[model samples]
Target: MKLNLFFQLSAWCICLCFSPVLAQQNYRNNEDINKALRNLVNNHKSHASLKSLTKTLGGKDVWVLTLSNGKPEAHPAIVIAGGVSGNHLLGIELSVKMAERILTNYKSVLNQTTFYIFPNLSPDATAQYFGKLKYERVANAKKTDDDRDGSINEDGFEDLNNDKLITLIRVEDPTGDYMPLEEDPRIMVKANPQKGEKGTHKIFSEGIDNDKDGVFNEDGIGGVAFNKNLTYNYPYFKSGAGEHAVSELENRALLDFLYERWNIHSILTFGPSNNLSVPLKYNSDRANKRIITSILKKDEKLNKHISEIYNKITKTKDAPKSVTAGGGFFEWSYFHFGRHAMSTPAWWFPKFEGDSLVKAPKNRKANFLKWAEQEGIENTFVEWTSIKHPDFPNKKVEVGGIVPFIMDNPPYSKVDSIAIKHSEFIIEIAKIQPDLKLINLKTEDLGSNLTRITVDLYNKGLLPTHTEMGAKSKWLRKINVSLKLGKGQEVLSGKKRLVLGIIEEDSSKQLSWLIKGRGKLQIEATTPHAGKQSITINL
Candidate 1:
């Protein structure tokens, strides 16, 4: 009874937690959604755009909802886009949740900030979950002839085993290139090419190749993978990533709105790349091992803990194995415009951090199986079962794997926790306000017609005025204090303000300059995020 009550309570919280989503209609029949989005644009006092915000993509309008502090001209902006691939419901939910959070907490986060929030990038794809999805496919409802032999989504598969799961099946053939599951012994692996060892295996999707394209049903369904369609590493001539980067009207519409409206300083996108969380590969580029040391520098206990579980914790791939590259979000922010950017995985297979158990490599699959059963992710991947195949024989099909909604897609219960944690991180970084003000200025008049003016610059927030790299590269603006007296202001000696390296939270740096014969003079201070301030002096 207690366990049942816990689940009931969890179910209730799911409903309450996603009440915001209740406001969002299914994209297919989302007339109400359009109206709600339009209403938000009209009602919000801060600058917002409902005009030219939507564009026809694959025969439907994709909407771009923007929020900002009222400004006369285009302000630098950040675009947080989700539901790009259509299958990623968590992405859409998070982006919307974040926008809502920002609006409610406007006094703190939304100040001097303009945000472009597209909660659902692939509305067509998202509508699949409306009542029941046939095969759990359909992110964009795109009927593209994926195999290009001329039919569309025609060659699809199904869960013939009654396991309620769709997975690859391997049948043993004398000429095939896949081997029996070596690691898990129940799963299969691609045969090694170097050994010239023959593999007697043939792999097929859960269903027949309805189109008979000689390659099974490779081109299943849905709109293009939007992230893979961006211009930088745009899979130009590659199959479904699109004709070019930002080629889809859906992608173009949002890109146009962001680039035109906001001069974004930084971007923290949830994707498959990294900048803020550096892959080990970048450490060699810096040469200053301090950056690497700083991250690995903490908690010897954690280090010792990892040593017990993982033999090779070295990061092998910071990117996908695919050759068709879409110069992703990290590149767009970091390389193209020189903005600080970070892209993190929304979820990953567990790393052995002592927080999770240390399963032997041989027992890894079994451990995952055990945990999945306990955690309820087993709802997706069914147990390995035998099945008869037309092409090959004597094969047991393991329908269970990591391709499930539970782990790859974190539960709604975790959204609030991650939101609060990420929000705090954003605030911590946001505090790097370079804006210095003329807090105090005093002049002591000398009898010989000379006066000394002192100035103080205070850091208004958390992060220091400049990063060590920013200071060294002069990428960050220099804070200068000047006391001027008309033309040819008699100056004793102009001393350059000293940057005490990095300034911590709520710290102040002071400067004093001397000048003679002052009729009218001005003193000013500057920073990147805080705008600027100045004051006038006369004697």
Candidate 2:
């Protein structure tokens, strides 16, 4: 009996040591995510709180986890958002795992920096990954008529091959615009007419035209995409963009929460749009226009600096440049919300290196498949199989391609390591947030009981107190330097309250006041985005 009890206790100890690793072995569903978040908050009650902002159209809760050691509003804040694109499941995983790692190991980071983490903004669409028929979905559950053909969801994808996965179908035809690449026959590329290449095949999604409208799988179930529904450069009249910007519940809820949090100095998003691996360039023409569309010159310089730091910390190389389509939250956070916004896909297939005798393929798909083969990753490609299609009965139709979500997300085993590196990057960014300090104080006594008080308000942090674009925005509060006087204090020079327009990083502005005063007095410097500091002086 004693030996059995000892064995049972030993087994329990082993389970406790490896339980977290076991739980993270697979991508989590909505229920699992909710439970994980609740457990974190319950375990770390003093530093974490989870709130359900609202439910997505699919009834999944849109949760925001606030982590701070003290009052969240009192400290400079950073917003870490994930799942901006529904198809990027790795983003959701990274966001949640970063939060978990922070709560478990990096609790000291919360002392000066508050974090507002939006784990999964596209819950409705991300759920499709775990559904019966898996494909790359980007829309929510709003019941949108994507093709606008008067009928809703009539032309959805059909599993013709009975493979339980939605891939691509190609047809061999003389007038086709796409052709298989010569280097790798498994991958397809659009025929380049400029290079004298002739089309040999046409490719379409693995689906039948159920609506018989010539387009295959154009309109499907679900509604607006959260990433495409934001208010920056909104794609009007486009499918999945909704009737107007900020139309979906998830987008509106997130924006509303962000608008109210004036302490948020920067936003870090895990999404397909990337400005971290490679920074944005400044265009003089666009920056000078009445409506600015480019990053300001100063902001562009800051972006480059941060990009260098990100590369050094993450050791990520050869990151592919991604364009921000209209209505993406990544650009919206910078252009419209007026904050330091940064985004990255967080994971991609490593660049394929060929031997000196062979050149690497330029096509992304071809290169990805080559790298997958070298890494011994299996099941990423579905072999092309002949299938009888209703639309192309006369031609040879085959269904096959790279599997959905594999190219965008790494395998589950690699998630923890990726999350750790990204979490370190986030902590480095938080450490450099704008911090205000009062330094270089001088007091001179004049002849007749009068004194002159002077001090330099300095920004000691690496980032400026206000971004160049944020300085023009009315939403961001201005730096206020005020003097609190004793009973008999009189200000003979300098305004009692001074508004410093903007303070660059590692820079200072001198403020001097001629006063006829006595007894104890106080001076305070405050801003919502950068923290506040106060000093007491005895006259």
Which candidate wins on TM-score?
2
Candidate 1: tens digits of C-alpha lDDT, residues 1-539: 99999999999999999986774432223354556567666666565665545544545567666676665223334556666544555666566556656666543545655566676666665555452423444234445666666666776665556655565666656677877654355555667779765676666666666655556656676646566666554555555566557766666776676555424444556544433233323233343543222212111222232222222222322222222145354444443333344454444444322225544343444445445555665354555566765433355433334343433445556666555545544444444433355677788998587888887777664334443333443444455554445865677756533334444446777777778775888766654333455788885
Error of 2 at 532 (Å): 0.3
Give the TM-scores of the predictions, in the order they appear: 0.65, 0.96
Instruction: Report lDDT (CA) for all predictions.
Output: 0.53, 0.90
Show where candidate 2 strays beyond 4 Å.
1-23, 356-359
Clashing residue pairs, candidate 2?
Answer: none
lDDT (tens digit, per residue) of candidate 2 on 1-539: 99999999999999999998897776888788889899989999999999999998789999999999889999999999988999988888888899999888888988889999999999999999999999999999888788888888878888989989999999999899998898888988889999999889999999999888889999988779888898878999999999999988999899899999999999999888888899999999999988899999999999999999999989998898776889999888888888998999998899889888766888888999889888899999999999999999898999999999999999899998999999999899888889999998888999586999999999988999989888876657889999999998999999999888679988999989988878887899999789998898887
Q: Which ten residues in a row have the lowest lDDT in candidate 2?
A: 469-478
